[model samples]
Target: MRYFLPSKRLGFLLLALLLCGFALNFFMQAASLNMDAMSVFSWIGEYYWLYLAGGLFFFFLLLVFSMILPSVYAGSAVAAVLCIVLGIVDYKKLSTTGEPLFPWDLMLLKNAGEMSHITKGMIPPLALAAAVLLIAAVVWLLFKLPKIKVSLPLRMLFAALSVAMITGFVSMVAHQSSLAVSMKYQNIFWNQKVNYKQNGLLFAFAGNLRQSLIEEPEGYSRRAIEEIAAKYSKLPDPVPNVQATQQPNILFMMDEAFFDPTRLPGLSFSEDPLKFIHEEESATPSGFLLSPEFGGNTANIEFEALTGMSMYFLNDGSIPYQQKIVKMSSLPSIVSILKERGYRALALHPYDETFYNRNRVYPILGFDAFTSEKDLDNAGRITPEGYISDKAAVQEALRELKASSDPAFLHLVTMQNHFPFTKGHNGPNTISVEGTSPSYKDELETYTQNTKLTDEALAYLQQELLTLDRPTIAVFWGDHLPALSAGIYTDAGWDSEPRLKHETKLVMLANFNIGKEPLNTLSPAFLGPTVFRLSGQPMPPYYKLLGKVQDEMPGLSKQVLIGSNGALTAFTPEQQQLLDDYRMVEYDLLEGENYSQDLLF
Candidate 1:
């Protein structure tokens, strides 16, 4: 009963651990460390002073929070338990390139079997001894301090001094390279303070939180490349091989935010840039391509359309540009397959090659040649502050495509309509679209204007397509929904409530003298397979697998298995089953838990 006084001793201990834990987690998640203490020390020397200053500030913040909210001690305990649980759920995400274990800085081996030599060898004994000593010291002080009945001022002074001492110790530890000690303590703190269950166990895990909260980087990892290539090497039986007796040049154009909300039958755009796309005296048109994401992550959509494999089929991580995470196997495979069949594959973009590690990834992804800003003839073309105009990119693509031989495949990704829509131009004739938004009155007008600019660029590209003599297959689709100030679906009168808002269509136009007709193909994954089918090319094994699923689930195109509730919800029941099957193969391949020979075939 006495221990539960106005100033509970556990409060101080909890604050100390919580502050220390967060600091430790930061080091573990970002810094690389060695097992040898001396090596870690050498590295820590460079940044220890800064760490000390930060630690001093953080410790006081936690101390004040504890004094203000006594119930926070109990809350911290709950948080710690949740953090531990979530660490287990997303253990696979801990793999980093230079520093993989940093993500798992808070996770302690729950079972004896998981105990590595460091834990079993020296850490467990030292940690147990330190913890017991610290607990015993606190209990002894609590009992003795109250009995002594010291003056309130002296007690306060002593507490402040103790806080200072602890802060100094944390600073000393912070500057050391031996991240194991810091990470271990941080894990202990997270277990005591942060409730991991707020976002689900995995979501609460330090690595997952960092990824979501930070400006996550773009690019594919080496593991992803190898996986994609391996998957591609084993060709599917009865591949969708078609003849190219009079081979037509292929132009793959991906427009930035090229989505039409009124795609639902009667709902249509006020200005139709796509009207001409559907009526060519020498063209074939395919309507309504289902897309996966909206407003961002264009590469993923491009990956799906070109590779015929959903990102769901990918390893549960970003496509690590340098082999730190995933084992990719889609786009690169598509390019490789095309190359083997005597088709030259070239990729063109107006942005820097470093934009998404395009220089490194495009080559591995199977493009025979890559042209970006480094290759752009004109060095001084500006449109908007950060983006190159879409028309300029098209002009570059056309110039390169016309010069290439051997039935080439040109992949063109545009950047003009990428966010921050402003007036700028690449050529002498500049098209400007800007308006002042007065209380959302001009929101719709502004968005329509921006979309009009993108439509104009697409129309210009189509016009250029007219001049080419070789038969050409042209396909275009939105990367994601535009970040229009007015909500895309709301402006179009779709449900405004945020629930499963990922749906867009792909439009395909072929210049083989095929009549323009509106065809209903309600599958997003069909973009890859259908493209191959219409182009008379061979479908890869991965594409065939996706093709089967798309054929079965026409309406289930834009759904993803986002973790909500306790179970993973697939976009639809059909997708749920497909996920289950994929998960089984995934577990086998990724974790060595279960293997299916069918996956190899």
Candidate 2:
């Protein structure tokens, strides 16, 4: 029943505690997330007011608790402990996934049991021990601190002022402030690493909190979607002659962290890791694929490829698999179109079925069956590097193709080459790097060796399909580049431009002779329509429009959209109109009342 009030001495000590808490939070977050200390410090200095407001808010909460607590130090100590715990969790999350912690991640706590694999190895034993010691020291200090008394009326007034100040600070950070405008740029839509690296984790999280809410697309309504769908309905339908009685078995494989490292300038490997790919590209339909993500966010590329929707239109760092696809029959995807054409669509991934909620998402995408890591193992398949090996994944795809007499569409997502390509891991180290630092060289070598294994698997799959009597086509591409050590490109004298960083290899190989025609560069959004074209399958009205756009645009992402001249340009009026129509249709399907379902499906 003792009441303690804030004094000048206590206020100064509390302010000092708040500053110390923030410092610890920043340092821990930076170290755990592999961020540059200097850059984080600079960001903090530039946005000091935001942090000051945040500090005062926390300090005010402590003051309210100090009214009932033994002393102000007790409340301060409690707040410090909570911040330390938060820092540890954030550090662990960033270490496992290159993605920094976002506000949306808090919703994922419900699935913590499923995320044990990802959350493991986040806190080292030494770090855990240190945190424990720090918490204990703070608690011991709290007991020795002195307490002050204040009148009840003054305490009530102080608490009200604290609440007002907190509200003012939050409002400033959210809107109508100069710092808010600058913070918006910190969010580089396609590349979240830059956002976190430049703005610091706290600001990045705050920015994403606003982005997490799904906003209605401009001009999005039931009537608008119907009108857009009707306008694009006149586009040419699939050519009748190309639609064979028996559709070819379609296999689309997204190799994890797979890219051609030989693209780096002045870089020579001990041997060509992608020798098979190079040989096949010469005789097959091949081109560079521009991905919307780098380092991670594999699911976003998969979403674009299957749904024929552009991530550029969505919020920055949005995970459509987790956020958009909530119902099984909502989103119309390529899988649904193929199923309508009597093709049995099967999805395969050699990892936990629950990662990114794939177990739930695949069915929503219209896959008849999803064979995940557990399913593969139940059937007696082996996994390499704690993942389903590419070789094993290909073998499963072939099995699925043969399982049903009906023409099949196999969507295989491989995970043998997931990131953290540390030194002396998963390798005979067949490839060597010349220009990069020793650490980068080691990581690159590991990545190259795994990719080589992936190439061998592709070659095996191609040969196996060739032996089969049924005509089949295989589309192979990388989801994104690996999360290699920083400065790898700068060290190799390669272009550090965003476009170059986002490039990955794409190849379309068919068993029957389709003639060796080269393809233009493509984004993942265009890949679905391109597959329908290559397979000679009839597509929906929206797809027909998308095909036309692909013919002109070829490749488009938030970072760069290919012009008719084959150069990056701001979308021309015509191009913008096409994109606007596309966006309207996408909104209709994903967020609006699904007005275009019958037309698209």
Worst 10 residues of 2 by lDDT: 377-386
Reference-based TM-score, model 2: 0.81
Query: Which window of ten consecutive residues has the lowest lDDT sum in model 1?
Result: 195-204
lDDT tens digits, residues 1-601, model 1?
Answer: 3432435454456455557655543333232222234533553455454344434544454443333333334333333434333333233222111112223233233323322321222223786697679667755554554222223453355357647755554454333224424432232212211322111121123323223111211233334334543554464534333455666677788777665533523333445533444343124555554555544556666665554445444333323342321234323345666677788999987765654455666776688888886687573344334356666777787788789767788888877655433222222222222232244334334444445555566667777778877777777766666554443345444444222245444566655543454445343445655667666666655555545555455433324322222123335676565544433333333323212223332
Tell me how candidate 2 scores on lDDT: 0.72
Predicted structure with the largest lDDT when compared to the true one: 2
Candidate 2 segments exceeding 4 Å error: 1-48, 60-100, 106-204, 212-218, 238-243, 327-329, 378-385, 467-469
Note the Cα lDDT for every prediction shown: 0.48, 0.72
lDDT of 2 by residue, 484-563 (tens): 65477666554447677788999988787655667767899888777777667766788877887787787788766776
lDDT, residue 141, model 2: 70
Question: So what's the TM-score on candidate 1?
Answer: 0.55
RMSD (CA, Å), candidate 1 to true, equals 16.9
